[model samples]
Target: MSDLVDQLVAGALDRVTAWPDGALARSSPPPRSVLPGSFNPLHDGHLNLARVAEEMTGATVAFEISVTNVDKPPLAVGDVRTRLAQFAGRARVELTRAPTFVEKSRLLPGVTFVVGADTAERLVAARYYGDEARMIAALRDMADRGCRFLVAVRADGAGRVRSLADVAIPQGFARLFTPIPESRFRTDASSSAIRAGRRAAP
Candidate 1:
């Protein structure tokens, strides 16, 4: 990792260690809630989610940019630095490359994990891991440790969103925010779109 990226991650780790439940030794204190993503280039949706999460929970939001996407190639360390700069001190957002879901879970034991509808569907679909129940169980365990999840709704091609009512939120979520319908910000820029440099990804 580049020095700057390392600094950002270290700074984020410091903050995480300072939360009410943050005890570095035990790895038990639920750090501030985390919104982990690749963020090839931070976008408005991310900013919106951070703002909305703070509005809904009144807690600092941690923007975790993990380097562990099996589907996509990893981003350069400098890219991580640039993105961190983009989010510095915005509603208690912290940027870091988590590298693994387990690492992320361990780092933010008592915080909420933000994701989208597609990830949520995979969390329960046996086809993805052949043990949907195991995935659910793990997430529940994290919640039991004071960690939970906040799943946001992503827009479809027609500017529609999957309602929160459509998904089953397992027990133990620290807090749950309603899915933001497509009517609020009908964005078309996604991370993929940003990477492709075609139109823009929402």
Candidate 2:
């Protein structure tokens, strides 16, 4: 099983792989919508967000886990299996090498990416891409691929709840983002906090 898992992760590094609920793995077509996350433990917050996203978009939401990372090392086989286990019997998932939305857009064009407010904030922040011009170019590339974002509410570092409205989207890219009203869904559960709690446990 571990050897198979290793192969799956290796293949995903080259192209997207789809794991359907209670089914086998295969190549992925462009999903209508995707909720990409690290899913360290696949908590309720993620499930609720996907539920709301599906209801709003009228499309089945597939979960995505990128084995590659921009700031950290790629996930090891054991780590990938642990995260993939949480989705078993619950949701379909896609494994890919895309570490950024721009890369993901190119792989799965015309898909709506379900994201939290914090992610949407970073998407438009010039610092993330080195400069405003680079940021704009990346966004233009995503838009050109017909990618859009569905932003959900999330609490910022200051404990203030933020939605898409709080994000400073660049002028021309406004249409690429849509907000999931706080009335529809909200969750305080965070994977970082969960991991911290586990580490603190005696």
Count of clashes in candidate 2: 0
The 10-residue segment with the lowest total lDDT in model 2: 12-21
Candidates' C-alpha lDDT: 0.56, 0.87
Per-residue lDDT, model 1, residue 77, is: 54
Cα deviation of 199, candidate 1, in Å: 7.4
Worst 10 residues of 1 by lDDT: 17-26
What lDDT would candidate 2 get against the real structure? 0.87
- lDDT (Cα, tens digit) per residue for candidate 2, span 1-202: 4344476567634444446464545555778999999999889999999999999999999998888899998898789878888888777887778899998998889999999999999999999999999999999999999999999999976788999998999999999999999999999889989999999999
Off by over 4 Å in 2: 1-5, 11-13, 20-26
Query: Model 1: runs farther than 4 Å from truth?
Result: 1-31, 89-102, 157-160, 168-188, 197-202
TM-score of each: 0.67, 0.92
